[model samples]
Target: MDEIIQEDKKVFLYLNNLGDPSFDQLWMLISSTWIWVPLYIIFLYFLYKNYQLRSLVFILIFLALGATVSDQLANVFKYGVARLRPCHDPSLEHYMRIVKCGGQYGFYSAHASNTFFLASYLGILLKKKIKWFPYAIFVWAIVVSYSRIYLGVHFPIDVLVGAFAGSLLGVIFSVLAQKVINKQKITP
Candidate 1:
């Protein structure tokens, strides 16, 4: 396992250091939260105004669950696998941006996981009222995941896995919430 991780790190170092200025610039542009904050506010306002209080509460609970699950899963993978980040590996030392150096193991990105989870959970909840919500969520997830890679804090694979794991958790929570809502008989 250690040998495989080392080999993967070597490959990532070579690929991630392509040093394309345009790519870097694009990444920087997408990574800014100025765009995300407005979108978040709009979504929150819509949810608060359009949805019933119970539904809003359920969605918030599911969002929290998704975030918690993502965090715990990231910690488990980071410690259990013990893979080193590109910035931390001596072989990849020259390739790193240095400023974005993070923890030793970067197998899974918490940022990507958390953002993706929130996006997926909210996207599902808002799918009917806002037809474009899912697309926006997907775009947000992609941008967030790309930021992790562009900042030299995580490899592409790490972000991809984090996104996938987060999406799964979001779906699970959504389904559970639906079940609970259906089982309970609400009075009109």
Candidate 2:
């Protein structure tokens, strides 16, 4: 465990040091949730175009529930694991760039969790409808996850764990959504 942690720190430092001041603003903007509102609206447009009214409502509900679950679950892990974020770590404080600092604990990042959850859930739900969607959304999720690292707020392990957990939740919720839609006989 100690060796793994050391490796995680090494990786985090390598990635975090790659940032330049010129790109900091771009990454900060990308890291902001509100900056993605237009993207979310575009996602809604895709959902609206693909699914019927009743099915779309159920899908949206599942998305909300899945996002909530992903975020809260990450919070649970953050506090429960008690892992210090890179910016908040005393040892790394001087070594790291600290472009943006978040809370003390960052065992797993909620931002990564939420974004990956959306990517996984919507990718599965809309794969057949829009062939390129899954690829595009997964790429988006990767970029978002990387932003957390670039900002020095999360280690690679934190983002990786969050992505894994979020993807699991996405699959679970997508299955449930499909079942409910089928039971209600709502065609998409």
Candidate 3:
């Protein structure tokens, strides 16, 4: 486990060092929630388009709740694992170029968790309607996840675990959302 973890750090540093100052702002924007307003609006539009007002309300509420759960779960892992972020780690502090250092712990990134949670949720929700949509959603999730490492705040493993956790949470929540929809008898 220790050797594998050491290799993961090596991979993290390699990926983190791949960033250039010229593209920092672009990545920072991608990693930011504020910049994703349009995407959220689009999601709302899709929900509204597919369901009646009451069903939309239930879907939106559960979606938000699921996202919150995913984010909070990552936070728990961060504090529990107590792993220092790459930017905060002493051994590699000098070797990396970081634009945003962010919080002290980076065991599993909330950004990765939240984005992938929404992606997986929305992706699976809309999978039947749009044939190719789920792939696009997952691609978007991966790019956003990569942005965290580019900003030098998270390790590769951090994002990987986050992706996995968020994906699982997403599937779980989507199932819950489906149950709510079924109980409510929401027809798309």
Candidate 4:
């Protein structure tokens, strides 16, 4: 376990140090949640398109619940694992380009988990109607996840596990939401 973790750190340092100063602002923007507001608003359009007002409320509620679950789970892992954020890592401090340090623990990233949760939820919900939706969501998720590393806030493994866990949650919740849709006979 120690050896593997060391290797992971090596890989993380390599990736985290790749960003040039010129692109720091770009990565910073990508790592910020506020920058994604327009994209989220676009999601509102889809929800309105797919369901009547009542069902849209239910779907949005479930989506928010899924995101909440993803965030809480990530927080649990962070505290349980007690891993330091790359920016806060003494060993890694000299080796990486840290634009900004986040919280004390960063075993898994809530940002990655939350974003990927939305990606997975929206992907599954819109796949039937939008053939390219899933791919786009995953791409967006990846970019956002990588931005965490670029900002030196998380290791690659942190984001990877977050993505996987969130993806699983998304699948579970989306399936449940789908069952409800079917029962309600709500067609997109």
Best by lDDT: 2
lDDT of 3 by residue, 1-188 (tens): 98988998899889989899999999999999889899889878877776788777777887989998999999999999999999899988888888899889999989889888988888888888777878887898999999999999999999999999999999998888888888978776
In order of appearance, the predictions have TM-scores of: 0.81, 0.98, 0.96, 0.96
Cα misplacement distance, residue 32 of candidate 3 (Å): 1.1
Q: Which candidate, 1 or 2, would have the higher TM-score against the true structure? A: 2
Between prediction 1 and prediction 4, which has the larger TM-score? 4
Per-residue C-alpha lDDT of model 4 across residues 1-188, encoded as one tens digit per residue:
89888988999988987899999999999999999999999987887886787677768888989988999999999999999998888988778998988999998989889888998988988888778888998999999999999999998889999999899999998988878877888764
In model 2, how large is the Cα lDDT of residue 47? 94
Local accuracy by lDDT, each model: 0.74, 0.95, 0.88, 0.89
Clashes of 4: 0
In candidate 4, position 75 carries an lDDT of 91
Clashing pairs in 2: none
Relative to the true structure, candidate 4 reaches a TM of 0.96
lDDT of 2 by residue, 63-116 (tens): 999999999999999999999999999999889899999999999989889988
Model 3 deviation from the true structure expressed as Cα RMSD, one decimal place: 1.1
Model 1 spans > 4 angstroms off:
1-15, 18-38, 186-188
Each prediction's number of clashing residue pairs: 0, 0, 0, 0
